[model samples]
Target: MIKQTIAATAIATASAAVSAAPLTLEVFNPGEAAIFPVASVLVKGQQDAVLIDAQFSRGEAQKLVQQIKASGKRLTTVYVSHGDPDFYFGLDVIKAAFPDAKIIATPGTIAAMEKKAAAKVAYWGPILKQHAPQSIVMPQALQGDTIKLEGESLKIEGLTGATPDRTFVWIPAIKAVAGGVVLFNGLHVWTADTQTVESRKQWLSTLDRIAALKPATVVPGHFAPGVAMTPDSIAYTADYLRKFETAISQSADSAALIAAMKTAYPAAGLESALAISAKVAKGEMKW
Candidate 1:
């Protein structure tokens, strides 16, 4: 396990180092859905540090907080992979842990959160009641594809499939990527955001590009952390997506396609897989 690695364990030794950052991963509960391992990276510099995704729920976020409680370092930044409630709602629960932690989210995500505040009260307010979310802030709107925080550099790329407005972060240094959509594990990739045929084309092609990167580690919005993005993993994701396009081109009815694909998918949680596949494939949702 990486926990046993000298670099991974030496976090404590860098406690007093002149220049170093403290990084760690935290797991979050994905409600009734599969438990996704959400990573909360802590970058410690001097007497402060930053945290990534809190968790999916208040309870799970607390667990993350408890783990970092001993760090005794100040939490400085909080970057949300996207605007999904599943990723940032827990911020309310761990606000105290990072009293000054500024919530960093894309401008689109910030807008989404604002637009949904009224309709999705339960998802947003609960975080305040639960994690208290010290403050919700927008990312500086990092101009280029790459962004630098503290000293860590990140590449921001986006896709419009799972979520209408979502982007993933690529950390070159760690050879790791954090995608907002749950592309791995068992969750059927949500095609809810796809609204047009052309858009769907862009989405699929974009995912292919990310996979081609073949990251050493992948952290999607959901799913426990993946050690290495194997060719099988990337291929399966692409294949899963292509199946939808194929079913669409074939003009297969959603109902029948869903049933047939279900039998073929066999795997748990794939019922929606076929349905979503057909819907987006046919451009029913436009994208």
Candidate 2:
């Protein structure tokens, strides 16, 4: 009788632990209204939450603050997955709201942000105007590759990849992926930053790595409204990159390349991204 009681107790304890740490994901995307259709994911456990990426504008970050407050979970960490302005520019707002939440990012990401944050702010500050962040809030370098939430692990992948700064978070317990700048859906893929052919190839390789995980849920860092967060977005991004490469080779100038992409993706939003990417690819514009 004693042995049976001990076994039952252990089993019950294990089950309760599992139940307590079933991480749930809530995504916030400001659709097309904001400059970029960037996404911020709030990963929630029973009592704590970890936010992935702060949005681009102050207004959007304020919205995220409201969402987190509504979730009733204590915001423990804010992990900026990428160093881009769209990913971390709004950190000031988030940090102001949750002063105690740890703001962190990979060492590589921190390095990139440190290098470019000033220039990015200078460029977009006027355009964003009231929506711009009051000031940039840089994230501390995360020591390791995993963040713990309610005893569950949120693994940060791609540190060893070609671009260590551009990483994604993989939640193994829930079999979901919070794909950062490495993935896009329902919009023109941003190729301006990855101008070189080799860089684009490495990005495609990263997408393949995400697919290999076979995640049940995939949240893109940027996506159009109404687009489902699924593995299909991975396939869409890979295909768009290939088409973009082909257009780059065939077109004689940026205009031609832009025209080709528009013909291919007539309904796609974010023509600005396509235009700039084509210009950079064709050597007409220096990014």
TM-score of each: 0.68, 0.91
Count backbone clashes in candidate 2: 0
Q: lDDT, candidate 2, residue 107?
A: 90
> What tens digits encode model 1's per-residue C-alpha lDDT throughout 1-287?
00011112212211111122333333333333212334444444446555656665466677667766766766766676656555665676667566666666666777776776444445445534644344443344434455555576666677334443567666665556666553544434455555456766776676676777777655544332223333344555556566655655555566765655555455524244445546655556442
Question: With candidate 1 superimposed using the best TM-score fit, by how many Å does residue 166's alpha carbon deviate from the native?
Answer: 2.0
Q: How close is candidate 2 to the true structure, as a TM-score?
A: 0.91
> Candidates' lDDT values, in order?
0.52, 0.82
Question: What lDDT does model 2 reach?
Answer: 0.82
lDDT over C-alpha atoms for residue 198 of model 1: 70
lDDT of 1: 0.52
Q: Write the per-residue lDDT of candidate 2 for residues 153-250, one digit (tens) a residue.
A: 99999988889999999999988899988888777888888989999999999999999999988888766655677898899999999999999999
Superposition-based RMSD of candidate 2 using all C-alpha atoms, in angstroms: 11.9
RMSD vs true structure, all candidates: 8.1, 11.9
